[model samples]
Target: MQLKIVLAVLGIVGGSAIALAQTMQSNHGDGMDHVTHGQDKPADAFGLTEPGQGAFAALSEVVRFLEADPETAWSRVDLTGLRAHLVDMDRLITDTVVSETELPDGISALATGDIETRATLRRMVPAHAAQLMRDGRWAVEVSVLENGMELRVTSDDPAVVARIKGLGFFGLMASQDHHRKHHLMMARGNDVHAH
Candidate 1:
């Protein structure tokens, strides 16, 4: 028992030391000396806080929120669904190709990818288009194509049109501030895309 306890303590201390070293190295590049910036406490007290990787960080945040809330329904939670959605996001970002064209009112884009990527685009693009249309900012339409998907966005205002063209396909897909809330809702077993 004593040997196990000693090993556990050493493991934690070693992990903390690694985190502190990584934090100091990262902050060094930004011209911030983490060591001298503190007068009251040692720099080792501050360490890397992020849980690493974009998707993992997002899921960590959701789990933290759920743990803090008393009303979280543990039985209804669907973290697997959220993980699948994050995988889809990754595929969308890395595997797709987009071709854009200037339109009189806005812009048109054709997005194509391999077999798996095309399936991801088909699932995500129309759902995102629905979310964008709810704001009434632009007329968004998504058409399923054999090769991939087609997205056309239009607005009567020239400024909004220019903004649409500037944003192109990826920007428009990522435009909404709704993703975090959607993730939380989906984790709680709510059908976020149903509406």
Candidate 2:
């Protein structure tokens, strides 16, 4: 059982790494030169957009830095460094003008999942997890409950959940609705027994 959990955690980490790699590769050639969108355009498309661009630029800089020399880059990145990166990225996104362009349903779903996963892991894991946001990419500590495995997600956005689920451990962290329903059912069962 333990070995299975370990394998599952490895699978998730490996899958997320691959996804991040693919995303990075796909976005590599563009590098903030242009913005590509599908059929729908965001409502606030032209409102105020410099910050997002700047944030992406900053992210690009970090990616380059890491690519140039990972060993040195990693050493320079401490907890504070990670937090600073996140702040910078958050500032870039929040300050920028957002549009009604539906913001991509997948992006929102992934963000929601990311937030939930972070919260769940934080609550369940004893070790501290670090987060870094740079060059439009983010590195967040993701924990697998099966074997207490720790992995870092490197991505431009919060769309790392798909990769997380691919690892197979995501199902272990029950969704909020699932937990609530289970609790409700248990409570009902207890009520019947008490009567």
TM-score of each: 0.75, 0.17
Report the C-alpha displacement of residue 118, candidate 1, in angstroms.
0.7
lDDT of 1 by residue, 1-195 (tens): 999999999999999999998887766755376676667766345675577898898898899889889999999998989988998998999999999989999988999999999999988999999888986778998899989999999999898998998899999989988999999998888988842
Top lDDT: which candidate number?
1
Off by over 4 Å in 2: 1-52, 70-195
Query: Which candidate's TM-score is highest?
Result: 1
Question: TM-score of model 2 relative to the true fold?
Answer: 0.17
